[model samples]
Target: MSTADTTDNAVRELLLVMPRLVGRVKRLPLPEQLRSLDLAPRHLSMLSLLLLDGPLTVSQLAGMLGVAPTTVSLIVSDLSRKGVLVRREDDADRRRRIIDISPDSRPAIAQWLSPGARAWRHALAPLSPAQQRIFVDTLLRYEAAVSTPTRTAPRRG
Candidate 1:
């Protein structure tokens, strides 16, 4: 087979298995620290986003999580009560509340996230720096694409 054929086949195989891989990870048990605090698996995503993007308002987080602002507020309240997150009034807008991860919880979040970092590091070790960046950027782009909502027309009842 030609190189293009081989690449196409590889892409097809990845498309078929990627969802199952994500499903398996989703089904995995939450880290003990999170479980102890009664946070759901979705909280990990919330925590990661807060860690990366810094503090965000309820509306911002709700948009990111694809949920209602009230839902994000509830999650933020839970995390705040458990000391995993802090809710503060936005400086620019007192009416808006910004949610951020607690400083004390950073160590636990880092520890929980380290395994994935290690795995990615190991996988990318053989790649040149430029190739590694490209690969990582491509993955991020793919994630962004999939997370975007489709603009389908409303269906009839």
Candidate 2:
């Protein structure tokens, strides 16, 4: 088979598998404390960042998330009210508030998110660093492509 055919086959396989992968991840059980919060994808992303990278300020989160600081602040405020997150004064910069998963919620969040992390680690472990970079870059490109708005051609009768 030509390289084009091989690439098309790989894309077809991914198209078939991606939905099942997302569905399985979505079906993973949430912790009892988190069940009532109605957490969205945005919340999951924020929580994942905090869980993996430790605490960060709202501006830092905004930068990492590619969103405005006000957006991150709103999420932080909602999660804070739900007892899922804590905001503390940054020692180095007294005016800035550092956001983190509350001690009470940390273990539950970790337990909920760890399986995916472990699975990614297992999948990437055998890859060379350069291979890993390429894989990540490809995924980022895919995300960007999907996120871009597409214009449709006008139809004629």
Candidate 3:
């Protein structure tokens, strides 16, 4: 097969598999504490970052999340109110607040999120650092393409 054919085949397989993969992830059980908070995708992203990177400031989270500081603050505030997150003074910078998962809620959040993390580790373990970078970059490009709006051609009668 030509290179074009190979690329098209890979794309076709990904299109078929992506939805099922997302569906399985969505079906993962939410812990009882989190279930009542009415969490959204944004919340999941924030929580995942904290779980992986430890505590971070609102500006740092906003930069990573591609959102404004106010937006991150709102999310932090809401999660804090729900007992899922905590904000404390940053030791290095007395004025800055560091956000992290609350001790009370950490286990539940870990329980809910760890399975997916482990699955990713398993899938990526065999890859060399370069291969992992390529894989991550490809997914980032795919996300950008899907997120951008496109105009469709007009139809004729």
Every model: Cα RMSD to truth: 6.3, 1.5, 1.2
Highest-lDDT candidate: 3
- Whole-model lDDT, model 2: 0.96
- Go through the candidates in order and give the clash count of each: 0, 0, 0
Instruction: State the displacement of the C-alpha of residue 28, model 2, in Å, after optimal TM-score superposition.
Output: 0.6
lDDT of 3 by residue, 1-157 (tens): 9999999999999999999999999999999877889999999999999999999999999999999999999999999999899999999999999999999999999999999999999999999999999999999999999999999999999
Q: What is the lDDT of residue 146 in candidate 3?
A: 92
What's the true lDDT of residue 26 in model 1?
62
Note the Cα lDDT for every prediction shown: 0.83, 0.96, 0.96
| Two-way TM-score contest, 1 vs 2, winner | 2
Compute the lDDT of residue 59 as modeled in candidate 2: 95
For 1-157, candidate 2 gives per-residue lDDT tens digits of 9999999999999999999999999899998878999999999999999988999999999999999999999999999999999999999999999999999999999999999999999999999999999999999999999999999999998
Report the C-alpha lDDT of model 1 over 1-157, residue by residue, as the tens digit.
9999999998899899988878866665566776678666578778878876888888998899899998888888888889999988888989998888888887788767656656777989999999999998998898898899979999999
| Candidate 3 ranges with C-alpha deviation above 4 Å | none
Could you tell me which 10 consecutive residues in candidate 2 have the lowest summed lDDT? 26-35
Q: How are the candidates ranked when ordered by TM-score, highest leading? A: 3, 2, 1
